[model samples]
Target: MRIPGPEPRADGGVGAVAAAGGLHRYQLWLHAEYGPVVRFQLPGAETAVSVADPVLLEATAHIDKRPERLFEFLAPLCEAGNLQVLPTAEHTPWRRLLLSVLAGRPSHERHFGQFAALATDLADRWAGQGDREPVALQKDLTTLSLRMIGAYALGGDAADPDKVVTAFEEVLTEHLGRLYQVPVPGTEEERARRAAQALAHLRATVDRVIAAHRSGGRTDRSDLIGALVEAGERPARIRDTVMITMLAAHHTTGVAVSWTLHLLGRHPEVAERVAGELDRVLGERPVPDYADLRRLPYLDMVVKEAMRLYPPGPYGARETTEALVLGDYEVPAGTVIFYPFWAVHMNPDHWPDPEKFVPERFLPEEVAKRPRLAYIPFGIGPRSCEGAGLAMVEAELVLAVLLKRFRFRPAPGHEVTPIERFVLWAADDIHMLVSPRVA
Candidate 1:
């Protein structure tokens, strides 16, 4: 049977996507008009099938490969190969190794102190800003996340955190700007040179860390670089792995926290509930310990709901290796299967009053009623983020600290808008009036 979608346009879906604001909104419109499975034109992929139903997603879950053309933008980040599009044979082991460290409790515990310190420092800075100054949640929080991941990925003392953050931002800004045609400051040649230099610096920094690991004969399971080196991954692959890990970790967690705060700012009652949970859990303590995280289930619920509303990475794509059946439709071999995560989270059948912000939707009994893929902020299947576990820990901790210390209200007269970028980003940054909370 034929999958439904909008009529083809000469601009190859660009006009439609832009007309609807961005790809995330475009996906929502497509699914609303065409049902769960829609075959549509995706600029690079030409014709793609998007599945917004969680039950339908199971069929595509095992399809491990991502469409290469869609991910070619990330190719320049790696010297070995773009980690996103690596062959399944190579990707399987890599995913296993990443999961071992990124998904491990010991790694998270080892990094908890550093992550808390970073979060506390950001809170301190925000506190110093005083209530009158509106904090740029996206800017400061993403920077804090970058620092946290830097400390985690490259040991706390391996490289200058500020330099690493600056260099990575330079590399990302240049590459993503070029891809989106965002009109960055310098001429094309200048931007390219800056990106190349930043990439070289980042690669060299990873090499230094690798050299130290080799010389010391370290094989720490909690250490990302050490684990990769101990696994006998070559220097280039190690560099690529670090680059990709940092890249993936940096923005997603930051924005998760920022968006949560953005939601809390607009919903003060929910913010108060989150604050009450933190107070009951930690008393007067400002930041949460690693163990304290599991105690604050409400904060976790809030973060999950926030991600459901504004997923950090709004959409994901996979390439089918064989023919498959999705509900009433049959997709051919080598088809581009789009996972509209944001839309899936908004599916009315699963999420009643899908537009409303209600943290209770994530209550244990409530969550048990929905399909597994319905709330996939991290994504689904084999290619899902290995950093999911870590990202959650980091986000919850940051939210715990910031909410425990401050009352965030929307900055007066400032409008917050969500636009699709490398991640779902606040186009103008989420500005909030952050004032200290009284005991």
Candidate 2:
């Protein structure tokens, strides 16, 4: 695949690597050479294949070991698998039918207290800071999402929320960075040893919650823990599933929110428009909740544009169940077929002025013109994100709260470089100065 400029090509053979960039730049390549199927082999491990071929992607995502291999790129913190990283067969069924935190009692809809508390806390703190100092809006927002997700997963007073996030990021960053380099045997051993220690701690943490809930511990509550505690007699799977769910929902949401903030900061006009809409939808001292998100049409558009520009996950892959042929590319079982999110998000045919930051184009009339699968921020088909509903609410709500309160801009020289993998992130930092929107 050919992307005009100096970006790396798909090594065609093996050991070819590409630099981290927005998916739009990579879309040209995916459609050109690979059309739908592509190959990539990181610095270490086995040779792998990648594909944006939607049909083939479905089968790959369904592979039992697919999630596990993907997780290896993640810190072992998620090795246990979050909803996103779990093997397709195991995760899909439970996520689709069995588990119902999103579609069940105390659904995200019923969780206003948690989301509001987070937004309020952020406003109160930032409001009092006095000076218009540049804040890493992304960093602050990520912290908020992590804590809120913890509250949802465990109880309101989930154990050491900061510690949980710190450990998770350490493992995630460490593992992702290691991908660009060779894995030393000694380093692998060290990571496993650390992972074992973390696993022991995590198991202990899960055990305590299980023990408490099983032993008639009741807070007159029916939060995430309570639902899982009574997950239909299969206590172990339920508990494991809860732990994994938090892992999936927490960090992914945080990174996505961070990117949104960066996009709004960079595009001041869009930021102003979103703020104006927030005012219309929610008047003085407005707080975000499930109900308010629907009224946030501008905020929703902004989010879609951000996801289009800087997708949290630019690529997703799966393994073949049997021999498959697509666009003249053939692959057998055990081949890692990849579908780069970065590739699909930026096809010129699909996106006009693809490099520019424009949100209104996502309006219903315009969106209806795009082909199916052309815009897949949350992905498509069976393997699409189960938490998309929750994510949409979370994003719109956070954007509403933030845009209403501050006028943010990129720091003097901060560049929002992104890392391409399971999620996209600012490679350096998203530093922004937040001035009161005194308009």
Q: Which of the numbered candidates is closest to the native, going by highest TM-score?
A: 1
- Per-residue lDDT of model 2, residues 1-439, tens digit only: 3211223445632322343233433444545654555554433324456555444455444444443455555434443344445556665566654335564535666666778778778877887885467776657877787777766666654477666666555444455547545343457678756656655565556667766777876533345566555644254565555555565666666677778877777778878788888888778866765767778887888888888887766665555557665545556766655566666666666778777888877899998887666677776555566667677677777777777887877788767777654467676667877778886
State each candidate's clash count.
0, 14
**What TM-scores do the predictions have?**
0.99, 0.81
User: What shift in Å separates residue 180 of candidate 1 from its native position after superposition?
Assistant: 0.8
List the candidate 2 regions with Cα displacement exceeding 4 Å.
1-15, 18-36, 40-49, 53-68, 73-89, 97-99, 103-106, 157-160, 166-199, 217-223, 232-239, 327-334
Worst-scoring 10-residue span by lDDT in model 2? 1-10
Q: Rate the local accuracy (lDDT) of all candidates.
A: 0.92, 0.63
Clash number for candidate 2: 14
lDDT of 1 by residue, 30-145 (tens): 99998999999999999999999999999998989999999898999999999999999999999999999999999999999999888888889888879988888899989999
